[model samples]
Target: MTTIRTVTGHDSAGASTIISHGPLPGCEEFIHSPGFSAALVWRTPPQARIVDHPGDPAQAESVIPAPGGSSALLVTFPPDDLAGGADFDPLAAAEELCQRLPGLGERFEAEAPGFHRTDTIDYGVVLDGEITLELDDGRTSMLRQGDIVVQMGTRHAWRNRGNTPARLLFVLIGAQRPPRGD
Candidate 1:
């Protein structure tokens, strides 16, 4: 867990102060595979924009209602997780997430080849190790530390090719698809 410091305005002081500093509140950790895990860092509800304030301290506890919302998460993929070997269960992790997060279950399709698309613009940064991002078109890219990917509602999957666990920080923001027949 990462320590999150929250700063807010001090009454009658006209200065900002650290009101809270510690691990994220209400953070949920999910172990998908043997070495793969995901932690929900925070989430913002829809229907309005954030105001100029410290925001909700318990906001992290709110589960994402749907795809058209904002969320930040940390995902770790273990090596050989996507190799499709005898030990690897490809759908096990997805199924687990789908069961826990209703939004994920809504996007997942039974017939898809482990490839799913979401109505969100995802900004993913490789925090450690290396990972391969594969798209539905068979194109793939190897991302290392400091690499950033702008995933625009694309159908994709992640695989860790390195011996170490690959950690990625993703900030997904809600997006609306273009109207049909345009």
Candidate 2:
């Protein structure tokens, strides 16, 4: 299984009371693993969360945080072929992603080889190089730096045309919502 690592992000997160919300239902609070670990928790409502880190200024990214309710968390999954991947279907996962992340932008088709996602809202910012976006009408768009894209139900794909590897901050949200207060 191929392993995907995360780079150390912003530093100095003081002890503050930030609401812990997730894209999925029954998720409310969050806690730090230890030593203010970078582990982001998905807690049920009412109960708050505690954070702990290993004293290391750098921490691996756990989950993409979002607002509460349908726009609570940004679900991210490794490429289907990645090792120990979230094993989440891209398309089907989109519905849940939409409910989790709100005020989303547009989605485009990526031309990344080994692409596999069914029913998932795939949204992300292109990091480096260029990637192609496939549309439902069989149309395609070239996504470069500073361009944001979102995908749902429609068939799409990603292709990395740059020799140097490119990275992205991607999120999977739900489009269709379940019964109220679910």
Best-fitting candidate, scored by TM-score: 1
- Runs of candidate 2 with Cα error greater than 4 angstroms are 1-14, 17-115, 177-182
Residue-level lDDT of model 1, residues 93-169, one tens digit each, is 66776655546545765576456777789999999999999897689999999999999888888878678878898
- Candidate 2 differs from the real structure by a C-alpha RMSD in angstroms, to one decimal, of 12.9
Best by lDDT: 1
The worst-scoring run of ten residues by lDDT in candidate 1 lies at: 57-66
Query: How many backbone clashes can be found in candidate 2?
Result: 48
TM-score of each model, paired residue for residue? 0.72, 0.37
- Writing each residue's lDDT as its tens digit, candidate 2 over 1-182 gives 12233322233565443232223331322121110001122211222233332222112131322222111222222222331135535454443333333222113223542234433454667755555665555577877777888765355655444443334455444344345597
**Least well predicted 10-residue stretch by lDDT in candidate 2:** 30-39
Clashing residue pairs in candidate 1 are none
